[model samples]
Target: MIQRIQSVFLALGAITSFGLFGTDAAETEVPVAGSEVFADAQYDVYDSLILTGGVLAAGLLLLIAIFLFTNRKLQVVLCNVALMITLAYAVYGGVLWYTDSAAAQAQVDFGALLPVLTMLFAALAARYVRKDEKLVRSADRLR
Candidate 1:
C-alpha cells in the first residue's frame, strides 16, 4: 500500500515537472495578465521538480532498506531527521514569501512537497518496525 502511494506521488511529480500542471517555462517569455503574452519557459520548474524527485527517490530507497533490515531505532531516527529538514525547507519557503521577494515566488511549486511526503512515509515505516519490535519483546518476556 505504501509503495503504491509512493509510486503514485512519483508519477504525479513527473507529470507536474513535465508541464502537465502549467505550460510556463522559466526561460520563456510568458505573458501575464495585463502584460505582453508569450510562452513561458520551464527551466526552473523542471530543475526544481527533478531535484525533488531525486530526493524522494532517495528516501524511498532508504525506506526499502529499512523494511528489509527492520531497523526500528535507526529508521525512526532517520525519519525524524528527514522530517526536521523537510520542515526547515517548508519554513524557509514561507519566510521567503513573507519577505515579498520574487525569488520566493519562484520557489513555490509541487516540488516543495517531496521532502514532506518522504518524511511521512519514512516515519510510517519506522512505526511499523517499532511495533514489530515491541511484539517480539513481549513474546520474549512471556517466555
Candidate 2:
C-alpha cells in the first residue's frame, strides 16, 4: 500500500488538491472612483462552493484510490476520475477569473496551479498502477 510508488503519487495528488485552501487563486484590483487607487480582492477556493467542493472531492478521491492498492483497476479508474474533476475545476476557476468585472488587472496565484499538479499526479499514479497490473499478470504467467 504505502510502499507502492503509485500510492505515493496518489497521496501527492490529494495533498496538492487540499493545498488549494491555503492559497489564493487570483487577486484583482478594483479601481476607486476618480482616484488613482485600487482596492485588492483575493479569491480562493472558499469563495465558491463549487470550487471548495470540487477540490474536496478530488482530494478525497485520490486518497481513496491510494487505499485501493489491492484493486489496481479500481484505483486507476479513481485516478482518472480525480484528474477529470481537477481539470474541470481549473477551467472553471479560469473562466471565473476572466469574467470578473473587478479583475481589470487580475493576477493568477499559486493556488491556480494546484489543480494542474493534482491532475499530473493522478495521471502518473494511474500509469504506474497499470504498469503494476501488467507486472502481476506477467508474474502469474511465469508461475
Task: Identify the leading candidate in terms of TM-score.
Answer: 2
lDDT of each: 0.43, 0.85
Model 1 C-alpha lDDT per residue in residues 33-135, reported as the tens digit of each score: 3211111223232334433444444444454444444455665565555455445544543443344323322334454454455556555555665666687
| Model 1 quality (TM-score) | 0.49
lDDT of 2 at 91: 87
* TM-score to native of every candidate shown: 0.49, 0.89
Span of ten consecutive residues with least summed lDDT in model 1: 34-43
Q: Where is model 1 more than 4 Å wrong at Cα?
A: 1-70, 103-108
Clashing pairs in 1: 25-40, 25-41, 25-42, 26-41, 26-42, 28-41
Off by over 4 Å in 2: 29-40
lDDT tens digits, residue span 1-143, model 2: 66999999999999999999998877766543432212336778876788888999999999999888899999999999999999888888777766666556767788778888999999999999999999999999999
